[model samples]
Target: MDKYTKIIEQIKALEADMVDFKIVDFYGRLRHVTIPTTNITDKKLQFGFGFDGSNFGFAETGKSDFVARPVIKDFVELDPCLEDPTATFMCDVYEAAQDVKPYESDPRGILRKACNYMQSLGVADMATWGPELEFYLFNDLLVRTDPQAMSAEIISDEGYWGSQDDDYSFATRLPKKGGYHSVPPNDTQYQTRVEAVRRLTSLGYDVKYHHHEVGGPGQCEVEFNLMDSMVAADCIILGKYIIRNTAQEFGSYASFLPKPIFGEAGNGLHVHFLMKGKNGELVFHDPNGYMGLSKMALSFLAGILTHAPAITAITNPSTNSYKRLVRGYEAPCNCCYGMANRNAAVRIPAYATQPEEKRFEYRVGDATFNPYLALASILMAGLDGVKKSLDPEGKFGPLEKMDKGWEPPVSIPASLKEALEALQKDHQFLLDGGVFTKGMLEKFISDKMQDHLRIERTPHPVEFEMYELI
Candidate 1:
């Protein structure tokens, strides 16, 4: 039987009462509808279920009608905590009239187009990506933003900064930035991480590892298995969902905010990627070459470095993201690459010893990005570099040594304004295959600029403390 037919049958056999047809929106939010399991048939999957797109920040109120076509390959079982047994499936948005797939405007459609573009260029049939999911687990989170008052507070029982006050436990606490690899009891959230990993693995995602991060307060990271860019993006969305839900089960909250706390390590979504041929051979591996990187691979790295600043507008969209990219915090602020250098925008991980295992990690992105747009944009930039043979002169340094004299010809943008400006000027590379259209680009820029203005007009709570004494 076909995949959808089998899935429907399995849902029935499992006594599932509801099925959730879900999709990740442009802002990385999960949008879905829970319908009776009886309604999930092969024909229904083919025709799609209708929804209001306006609420999703996608359409005008008058023309908000849209359809969601199930991507059966991206299906996964729902968590058992819900009242009814349910299965969730990722979907693609389609226009109501002709039932045609939406273009760049639809986040999922953009990912599809990027995949097609890759095929068109004969670059690679698939690009695999593995994103290291880092987040903060807090005991309590409170926030208020108003014209009269603005403040935010977070509490963590295991936080290094707050642990000293815990008279209940006399256990010695690690100093600031010393939380990495701390053992059980001191780690505090070890069981939480284990549960999160277990849940993710049960949902068919391969669990690489889970551990406490450098952030003292319940900061942790869970690494998922690598898959094609599209599938990987879907996993990222689902992974975030599972992490948050699991945290709630433990009476805690998990946040993917780039910088959730001051004077602490920031969370990052470090993405490792590999381009391979259909034969399952590593196309980017050249052991005899520098850093075991092939010509195509070097060109791809060059393209990414050249477009790194512009890509940030989408990859690190939020204003708060800039706070994490500051120097001395292990954030990648420079447009450069090196072997095993976490501070570089791109780093070739030394962990991969086999030929097929070789890949490069782009360290600049955070979890705030829409995975579909971010991955597609990065691929488009790389493809453009290959097509034009764009050489990233002096951008990549030796793997073993630090090149103090080396400076990137193009500097990465330090602020959202500069990043947006870079996007405005350097987005032609993203337009070659129409993976990212002019209209969508314009809308994205306009929307982000509006967000920038909103934050700029509002005075920060810290500003009051600084000026109140004056």
Candidate 2:
């Protein structure tokens, strides 16, 4: 009958015994509250369930009250791990009050506001983002930390050291830089990739393809078809959930940490985006321009490169993310664009010929990001570029070794603290059309700095390896 009734009917027909509501906090962590099916009601859908906002890294303890409402369209059945059939729905959060409104810090709401703001400015009708998510699957991971000792280790059946161990005689280990698209025996995670793809597509993710990434220690990647900004963010969360849980079921641990291994390629969530003009025409295509990108597209690229230091604060927010953003390992550290150049932070893919397909890829970001904040920040930067008519060609030259007077644009922020400081100094663009509030930016920076402080105080096991003799 009604929308809420239809949702209940679907859950009942699926034989779901429990309904789970999932939400994303400011730092992009997934949190959930599950209720038995018997508790499902139209009134509950309207009013939502309460949760402590402070626990979610948002409000302070004195003001920690929030509500979560189900996004019924995002419902899906759980994998067969549970004894009872369970359904899950991604949720939107609200401030807990007599007149509840969208929570300003709710990651999803932030993105929505960004999209609406762009339309209000008449920049574009829609934005589409395609992500190439990279990660690792380890056979096992161990960590031991105490006041007196700190140690850690990661074991991958595909690691080069495995052949020397007594467990396996077949030397299936891939070299540090030689794991991309390697065949079976060497690439032991092929079947596991298939499982992740099957689970993702079954849940409505348009997984284009999957393959082994360039890391010897079980690094992998999955590419999905482009979806609008909001849908892309939603799919990312779901895709990550599926990937992590799938790896667990297959007797492995999955990590999206940017730099889980040293001296090798790191995992990144590289995203490609294109926009639609107000006339409903794809705006990125221009055969006459460089890489068939429209003027608007180039301008968008300029915006992103100009604000990259601040954007890094949102896109690659974690401290480990900096390890991946550094100058080696094809990490895209330079603030330049090239035709399919892997070293440049932004590139116009030469393969995309169709107008709708022509887009630019930002290679600096990693999967540790909150997709909402990351995508929104990038879009706002691009919109600012369009407003300013910034010419990318003038900013940086084509991929070149060196020239007498040549210098790339300002380099990426060296660390999380540096990125945060950049955002603090130059975040006025994010305030355009009220897309990002001053409070949200301050809270985000304050909260994320804790991660940096936590790592700064801790002694890495590597430190002990070097300093124990000293």
Q: Give per-residue CA lDDT, model 2, range 277-392, as digits (tens).
A: 77768778888988788888898899999999899999989999999887768888878888878888897787888767889889999888999999999999999999999988
For each candidate, what is the lDDT? 0.81, 0.85
Candidate 1's C-alpha lDDT?
A: 0.81
The local distance difference test score of model 2 is: 0.85
- Per-model TM values vs. the true structure: 0.94, 0.95
- Compare the candidates by TM-score and give the number of the best one: 2
Please list the residue runs of candidate 2 whose C-alpha ends up more than 4 Å from where it truly belongs after superposition: 74-83, 163-169, 400-405, 468-470
lDDT per residue (tens digit) for residues 1-470 in model 1? 88778878878877887988887776889877888987677888777888888888777789878888877763447754465678777889877776365634788788889889988998888898988999988877888987798877787777655532454533535567877878877787787778878877777777788888888777898886678887788878888888888788888899999999889899999899899887876888998856787778888888888888899998998888888999888999888888888888989887777888878999999999999999998888888877877665454554345465666666668877788889999899888778888887887888788888888888988888899989
lDDT of 1 at 324: 94
lDDT of 2 at 344: 85
Quick one: how many clashes does candidate 2 have?
A: 0
